[model samples]
Target: MRDEIKGIRPPSNPAAIKDALDDIARIRGRPLVYPFIGSGRGRGALVELADGSVKWDWITSIGTHFFGHGDPEMTRAVLTVASADVPIQGHLQPNGEYVEFLRAVSSIAPGRCKHVWPSMSGTMANENALKIIRQRHAPAFRVLAFENAFAGRSALMSEISGSAANKKGQPDMGQAHPVPFYDPADASSVDRTVAAMDDAFKKHPGEFCAMHVELVQGEGGFRDAPREFFQAVFERCRRERVAVWVDEIQTFGRIGEYFMLTRLGLEEWADVVTIGKMLCGSAVLFSSEYNPDPGLVSGTFAGYTAGLALGAHVIRRLRADGLIGLQGKIRALERAVSERLQVWKSDRLIRDYTAVGAMAAFTPIEPDLDSIRSMVRKIFDAGVCVYYTGHGPYRIRVLLPGGCMSTDELKEGFDIMERCL
Candidate 1:
């Protein structure tokens, strides 16, 4: 079986992969993250790179492959769709996958979320969310979002995101107002955040249509907002009639709870929710009250047929495996990572760590961008793959697919990380 799987992977031509990367860089007119290509041979927690080298995939394609690479069930689901010759693009004709996939997503959504708008990417899902909010609250131009929030790469969402860097060289929508996110131990954090939102609301009274939050910021350093903090913020948005748009692009399935709104107890207040990454298909789940007018939300491609099938399979499998249920794999991985952090705390090289379920991030004591990047590269070279987050004070963020990885496997990856450090 191992040999058969190996044969199924990409041609083990390291030189060919390297040459392709060079060609891509030359064509795109910029340097790229060279020397890495997925071989599609990985099973569970490990991946075989195009260079014929195997490494523990701690990043899991930036939380997209939540079940890890070459998962048998995922493969089977995709193969089933492929065998049927389902159209790659399904916009012209409605398919059963669309209905079944939406049903699967709706099953997990809050009761009020009666409508689902399918899109090709997280950005488009968010874009649709904004469109729905705009249609529901016409002429209400302003939006509310947390500090360092990341929405998507699209022009409109780039404006909605809190990062100024993302909006560079793009025309500003100039509609999103930034507010402070929750800090767990900070007693005054909630008040400070509320004050920010209140100030923003007062500045643009009746102009704010919606507020988007990650609940747990993913790219912004995996920081989490406490339940009380989220509840207080949601209350303010509700009072101001601002639709709550939660961006679960990176936080969806990997957060252990399947949905961060539910994990953070903000599901009831979630007027619009955007989900992507591990689910394969990205979508916006909105309440009936926020449904948009016709011609407002449409896409050329909702998602690929295989992704749609695999998404439904993933949702069902995760539920059956209890990976998203209480004290499940998410919590188990969190505990494992937390235990490791506890031991690393005594190490002078370790600065701080944050372990939130399946996502974990840590910073070095003497941190710099170059050092962080070098450390990540070293970790990858040392047979484990992780990623970096944040700027100025960067962190090593590891998004492990705990549902498919064992605690011992996690320890082994951490061991490689330690050796790399």
Candidate 2:
């Protein structure tokens, strides 16, 4: 462990932090939950803020920094690409780094996904996937999405997302239809989902083009279902001739597998998939059958040169470091965190403890949005930064940096959480 991560302490420069927060709030039109301003320096899972206080970053930028902050390997990758002639790569003229990134991702992609399209963000990748599906099955514009699914924030994606708040004030595209996700508490959960899917197909008849599966719902409180449920859903889509699109944007590298579908043994059913966050850059992977025409999907910027290099390096390191199987380091961390959470649940400190690989979440005993938000703020103030997900009964979501976070550091974070509770 590094010296800065030894322990957490109060901010030394409160006035300076307050000034910076004020400036940021004035410019952004809203105050943040915590006055967090990074000092651009970190070691392992610990980051130093502008106020000279270091905290354990359990959320890892919502799963973007899988290797944690200031990873030496990632730093070297970025530096190697810094001298590129152009800062950003584009569709018309891509550099060698772009091709390298595609090859790196392709090396791990399912055999069905033979074609790849690069994009700047997850939303763009999802947009490209939607377009390819739509073009392949024209006039069949409707989509099948889970009730609490969160695709992205683009115009089409916002409409497709299951949150009404996200689609507020925007005209309803009426393109996405909802189906209930699996509930472990219900004995007939699998059958119930299949029935709902069947009803949608019957009602819409050939109007549906694809089904979006999150595998492990990120914004939906890290909730996940068993493989049996997914197999049933995929079978229904197959019978209906509706394409299966897996959105692994948030679950890609953190789920103890390069792709969650592969882990579930459902990769063969996936026609198109989108990945991002932990990959540094986002991309859409599809089968040759769904490949779009030349003029259908094109973007000005693929991504930054350094970002592509860093993404490729992350993938390579993940494979070489033995961090990607069912018995990998990611799963080991998940088990450690789940054990601590179980103790808290038994003690009545929390409820609904849910975990998969590096992602874990639990709802507070109170189970209200305001109360959960308060708990998150308290945890951040106590030296570990975590965020909340879902509504009705929000959960405190924990996303660990699977590649670098150690067991001892993880214990320290749970100790802080216990103290806060």
**Model 1 Cα shift for residue 123 (angstroms):** 0.4
Q: What ranges in model 1 sit over 4 Å off?
A: 1-14, 89-92
**Candidate 1: residue pairs that collide:** none
Give the per-residue lDDT digits (tens) of candidate 1, residues 1-421: 3345466655666667878788878998875542567776787888877777777888887756778877788888877778655655555675878777888888888647768877778898998899899898989979888877889888878876766578888887678788877876778999999999989988877899988898878877778866888889889988999898889988888777878777766678889999888888789999989888788888678888877777778788878888886678888888889889878877755888888878889988757988888888888878888888865478899988876888878888888887776
lDDT of 2 by residue, 1-421 (tens): 4455434454457887888899889999998877678777678888878777788988888766778888888889989989989899998999999999999998888859978888989999999999999999998999999988989999999877877788889998789988999999899999898999989888989999999989998887678999999999999999999999999999888888888998898889999999998888899999999999888998789999998887888889888999989789988988898899999989999876888888889988887888888999999999988998885678899888888988999999999999988
Give the lDDT of residue 379 in candidate 1. 84
Top-scoring candidate (lDDT): 2
Error of 1 at 183 (Å): 3.3
TM-score for each of the candidates: 0.94, 0.96
Clashes of each: 0, 0
- Count clashing pairs, candidate 1: 0
Kindly give the stretch of ten consecutive residues in candidate 2 with the minimal lDDT sum: 1-10
